[model samples]
Target: MMTRSRLMLAATFLLLSAPLAAAQDGEPEVDCENAQVQIEMNICADRDYQAADGELNAAYKAAMAAAREMDEQAGEMGEHYVGAADALKRAQRAWIGYRDGQCELAGFEARGGSMEPMLVSGCLADLTRKRTAELKAVSAISGN
Candidate 1:
């Protein structure tokens, strides 16, 4: 029997490999909006996740700025040093691990199937978007 980590690793490998294989074969650029086959779907899903990741990065930067602002305010007001930025950084790191593990578990339902990569990527994209929104909201509330 395969371990859970092995299952996740295989799915991740396939997700990474699909684009390279498609490119090497000279496949036309995928129309993600109308993806038909499993490989194309997987590639498009990965692309979506990548785009979400980019947005997440931007949100994280904004959140960090807000956190620093919070820290500065606390220091100026003679309140305890909030260390907001450090706390946010630690939370973000923990969130990343949680998101990866959660998405891997989601893909487990389709393990060893062509759909596993797509499932994993879709979960990643969805979770990343949610995290981005959360970060944006936090920044907005904390003096962004």
Candidate 2:
């Protein structure tokens, strides 16, 4: 039983590490600015995208809060006015779809290859940053 348990543990380790071994087969240090391998580049790009996405989420939340404030003001006017919050929610949903489709197209050149993820992630990061700026601009314009 002891020998069998050790054998199973060894097998499990190999199975779990196969992909990691293949990924870092000959790769060097994974530095974002000086990434030397495809995997490192992809990892850096994914990190950038994730960071951008987080910022975008924060901006969206702030924008949504501002929109709701506008809606509140309109409601206080006791008139049938358009809802800023509703419009913002609809536009944000549409923007997310557009960003995803556009980034997918951007990665078409490297489709099904190791570079596809990097390209897609880079595009996502760029668009997300731009969208965050746009949301901030809208909030500023709305005096919020």
Candidate 3:
């Protein structure tokens, strides 16, 4: 009976720490689809946001490159275009600030709860995907 009790305690401790461990390790221990606990769910949410952020970064880079190309073309034609890349850099910085604030507000519904991180991450993913689409459009327009 003592051994059984000890095993139960061990299981409880593992269960409680699983989410924290996964969060710190930056990888979920199980498949996202199979995530049933709060930590697993949060981990999955974070992963989704990370994927979206990756796409956004790629799109932003393409857009920046395209803008620089445009500036070069204008320069070769004896035309002056100032702050082409600078403007894009500034816009991206502002957008990041807006996205963070928006997600923080969205998470207010679950404030101080276990689900707040998931809520914030989901919001961030949604906004980031939208931003990626916008950057892709910019890249296309800039002839990248």
Question: Candidates' TM-scores?
Answer: 0.80, 0.78, 0.83
What is the TM-score of candidate 2? 0.78
Q: Enumerate clash totals for all models, in the order shown.
A: 0, 0, 0
Q: Sort every candidate by lDDT, greatest first.
A: 1, 3, 2
Clashes of 2: 0
Model 2 segments more than 4 A misplaced: 1-29
> Taking the tens digit of each residue's C-alpha lDDT, what string does model 2 give over 1-144?
469989999999998787588667754336798888887889899989999999999989889988888888888887577488889999999999999999999999999999999999999999999999999976886686
Candidate 1 error regions (>4 Å)? 1-22, 25-28
Q: Sort the candidates on TM-score, descending order.
A: 3, 1, 2
- TM-score for candidate 1, residues paired by index: 0.80
Worst 10 residues of 2 by lDDT: 22-31
lDDT of each: 0.93, 0.88, 0.89
- Candidate 3 clashes between residue pairs 3 or more apart in a chain or in different chains: none
Q: Cα lDDT of model 1 overall? A: 0.93
The candidate that wins on lDDT is: 1
Alpha-carbon lDDT of model 2? 0.88
